[model samples]
Target: MAFKPQSDSDGALSEINVTPLVDVMLVLVIILLVTAPLLTQSVHVTLPKTASTSANIDAQPLQLGIDALGVITLNKQPVINLLALEATLKAEFTKNKDVGVHLYADQAVVYKKVAEVMATVQQAGIAKMAFVTVEE
Candidate 1:
């Protein structure tokens, strides 16, 4: 038995026909070529250059948050007052001298309350502290 085309003629067509496949593939390639440029067009921007500062900090940072009610929290756990906040920071700093603190204050909270928290953190000897702000 020989492989043969099922057609009106009984004889086999020996040549492998790839013309239709090649035509379909070429059409796909052309479609991709037409749309690729549109997909990759982007806004050109002039970005400012700055000297990169080396960050030597390797310890996990503690988060201190003051919500709108003037309530304070140390790493999400509620602290009674600034004295408690200072105690928490002091204990954490004792474990890792380079421990950093990130402060998050709600927009409705008073600046004096935030400042009091900062002073407490400073008194705790935590030198690495930064105010966390949300971008518009």
Candidate 2:
């Protein structure tokens, strides 16, 4: 490298000195190339394989709805009371151990009624339950 002094009469230097920039970019590129292969390297192992079976994908969840008036319905059909609901749920549970219920309660329904319904469901030996809500 050579040094030059600027005279008062000389115009300002507008050209950029990109030699250092080019040097830095080349160094970065070389580092990336060296690390790229290392990043892709992984340990290989022999994996064991077992017999595959299909799940019961056809099983559908039961839809239990409670209207604003606190009337309970199972699968769109009206139920006389919580006892009937529990009987129905017990039967369904017997049919499918993995049975689930999607509970849809009206917003205006009383919390006590909902709690009663949940208790009935729990007593029926059903473990999986989901609350159905409308998206805003």
RMSD of each: 13.1, 2.8
lDDT, candidate 2, 10-37, per-residue tens: 7777999999999999999999999999
Top candidate on lDDT is 2
Deviation of model 2 at 80, angstroms: 2.3
| Cα lDDT for residue 51, candidate 2 | 97
Weakest 10 consecutive residues, lDDT, candidate 1?
4-13
CA displacement after TM-score superposition, residue 24 of candidate 2 (Å)? 1.9
Instruction: Give candidate 2 misplaced runs (Cα > 4 Å).
Output: 1-11
Error of 1 at 136 (Å): 1.1
Evaluate all candidate structures by whole-model CA lDDT and list the values in order: 0.91, 0.95
